[model samples]
Target: MRAGNVKRGVVGLVAGVVFAGLTTFSGASAETGGCGLVGTVGTPEIGVDDTNAGLETLPAAEIALPEQIYFRTSTESFNRRWSFAARDGRIYVKEAAAQGGWRSLPLPGCMEGRIAGVSADDDEVMAIDRDGWFFTMDHALSAPKDWNWSTRYGTPLWTGAGNTLPAGTLDWTWSVLSPNEDHVWRDTAGNDHPVGGAKVSHVFALVDGGCRIAYVDPWLPVDHSYELATPANGRFRAVKLSTSASTTLVVNRFGDLYTRLYDFDISGADKVFFRYSYEDQRGLREAPDMLSERVDSGTAAIQLPAPDWVRQPKVPGEITDRISVHKTGIGSDARELRIEGESGGRTGYWVKQLTDAAWRFVATDQPLAGTRLENTAADHSIDESIQPSPYSYAGRSAAGWTATVANFDISNTPTTLRVDVGNGERLDLILHMVDGLRQLPQQRGIGTQARRFDGTVEVPGDILGSLATQPDSIRQFVTSTLGGRRFTDTAVDVTVREFRIDGLSVTLGRS
Candidate 1:
């Protein structure tokens, strides 16, 4: 398994499939106070996970730092095998020759062995193979004390050690040779540690998924991808709760949190739950108020459990003014989202800037704006799970406007789908764009932009929004009376974290 000096091949264009999970995350709170919740834009500090002074909330998203986990370890090491994930644990790096060899780490390239499987947070490790090529690495481990070589793709996993590459940020393209994945420090597992400890000398091994995005200090011009509302004075507006019966509700935002799901009115959609945002962190706060401008007052308590059919009476835990929400509100739902014992998923805030912050990856065709998440389908549920089944959380029969769908479509939108609801309770995410299914291409979605988009397509004030041009049936709406509201406020809980039905003068990526 030792034959890679270099092997690269990436030219994708299928458009669809995503999902995720996390137990404890830190960044959130850009603004969204009046108990309406929803922030993101210049800054809106103040964290919460259990607010309940009045009700209605879903404005939480923060924690995006140092992210580079570990990469830069190449020589082919047993050919190729490396995986990573950190918040607490998870790593793989196969090439063990034989023997049980499932849980390994002794990579240096040129070939070694040991990289089994299994790691949460949505998980990814592709390789594709055949010729089209395959390589997707991202679930980091940690290692960026700065170590410069010159720069093509190395420095900035969080940078430190030696430091280099910051000149223009280096886009480089078309590498002739000398690329990446050297993560350094490899005693060969003989002992120097790192077979599992020292965090495996900085994780990195993603193909097709390419994984590697950390390092955003480009002088901070700002535009890492934004769009936030409901926190000017605060009325809260980042909702979506699930249980799935079929009322609809899609909501999708990425990076830090705000992912919802639900689809099943008669099995036509049949996808019960896959949520995000359930805040109930207790005396939360330990660090993270990134502060651009936001330190509001009042509202922020959660413990939801209203009886009488459930209209918003929770009391499981939560209360906030956010000091740091106990070190960024600790969270974890492990077991890969166990309905039986595994875990679910949710890790958002719109992040994907590899090569370090200086951000640059726009090219599905480039030109097209963004925001394209059409809809349709009265009932839909998927989870063909032939074997490994441990993900479940989109279920509720009478929890007030509920929906937790995304068993799996692959039509696109598979970061792992997320949707949790438990704060002031008032989730009616009913995303029923009903019509064809998929026909993408207000710029792009399916073929000429076919159909079949499930959820996550929020782009109201974004003009340059590009995917192509946007024009797939065109029909955008988000009324609870825009913000006036009548009966659709819950202070938080509506997470889909990334979706697109496509085709309708589309173009999003502003905020």
Candidate 2:
């Protein structure tokens, strides 16, 4: 995670909640609720319409206030009765009473300027301050008679579960919860079991513009388990993240939005294997194999529609800045997404339904025609190994012997061959595989019937003169290739067959 220059504030721990202009809603009245509890009831403050058009706009007078708000709803049964939103650094509580109106919740002095993000299930609300401090408020623990502000507010201690936040988590920009409850992992024996005997909720956050996740399991031990959740490509630096049961909405720094899906194939098995050791009398030992494998299916991140003018011809947009998703009751699938960003020097709000594939202007109700969004290409790599045989030459000549590379098999074509000798002496041969000798018959009676080819590289005259004078000098051979492809069995046998002295050839054993 990258560090930023943020104004850090100190948060004090207070024992009680502060009640200022707090309105109490009866449990019975809140129970007999209406449209607001399950989904958005009336017209939203900015984008969208009755027909569910994408990216529609409204006049300034008709535009609702509090343009920036973080509203969240959960699919949990106990928490499905209400929802919560954070705007202007203040937490607002809303329920079914009076057709679902929002009311400000009183905050203690310590929490007044600390809250940066808020999330709610039907039964409780959780908030994270700007400095990455976590706090939670439960309905049963706070207000039993009504769903209203309670005096009890603090971070959850998890009683005897022995779970705590990861150390050194100083600042996180944003946070959100997965809309669905946690599921159990299936074992190789076809048995389902929870991790640490408890189902867990995933809390994802942006730590210095990088995606990170932590497990929230109230009934289990969670220690030092916060992990990074960025994609393997490492191309997308997320500015915003909103998650559902199956899909997570990601907004990159370029203002392009993507829907990401995770596909994990987990398998585990227990097996017994034998190990051999010379020290043991029996010469073998039995060992247990605990096999565990986790594979990512590499699902492609699909880009969504953005403002028309922002994405022209073949280029991506850089205007989207904010995103909010709404999910229906009992179903953790995103139904609508509200996108707010700058377009043509003017800030605008755009709405996109999951069914619609394009963004439409809210005022005109006309779809924005533009090119489809594109994803970054995945990265690739290659590995190669080459081995060269040692050769020796002993002859009475001022000229050094010629070295030949013969009897080698290469899987891929190489562009250049590098040969390194001792004393800073080296030779590079540009390879032309098609022009080299191929399929020549091998020696008749030696091993199996086969064919062979040879490539020769001349040693420099200066290097040859130095080696001839110092016969005891160490000679080393190393070979490598240059190409963007894999090569296998690229080993060649090097032999000094002959030498040229005074423009006359002399065989290896000749004087």
- Per-model TM-score on C-alpha atoms: 0.18, 0.37
Worst 10 residues of 2 by lDDT: 1-10
lDDT, candidate 1, 1-511, per-residue tens: 0001110110011001011111111211112111111111011111222212211121211222122211111211111222222211123332222322223222222111222222211111222111111122222111111100110011111111111111221110000000022211111111110000011111112111111111111111111111111111111221211111111111211101111111111111211210111233234331121110012112221111100111111111111110000000111100000000011222111112111222112112112112222112211122122222122234432323223434322221222322233343322232322111111112211123223423332223331133134332121122322232211211111212322323212211111
Q: For each candidate in the order shown, give its overall lDDT on alpha carbons.
A: 0.18, 0.30
Among the numbered candidates, top TM-score falls to: 2
Pairs of residues at least 3 apart in sequence or in different chains that clash in candidate 2: 54-360, 55-351, 56-362, 57-362, 79-121, 79-122, 79-123, 80-122
Candidate 2 C-alpha lDDT tens digits along 158-243? 22212223443322222222212323222222232222111123344444334333323231223332233333223335555554
lDDT of 2 at 14: 12
By TM-score, how accurate is candidate 2?
Answer: 0.37
Which sections of candidate 2 miss by over 4 Å?
A: 1-90, 95-102, 107-114, 121-123, 139-157, 160-200, 208-224, 244-246, 261-318, 329-335, 342-348, 353-356, 360-511
Off by over 4 Å in 1: 1-125, 133-271, 276-447, 450-511
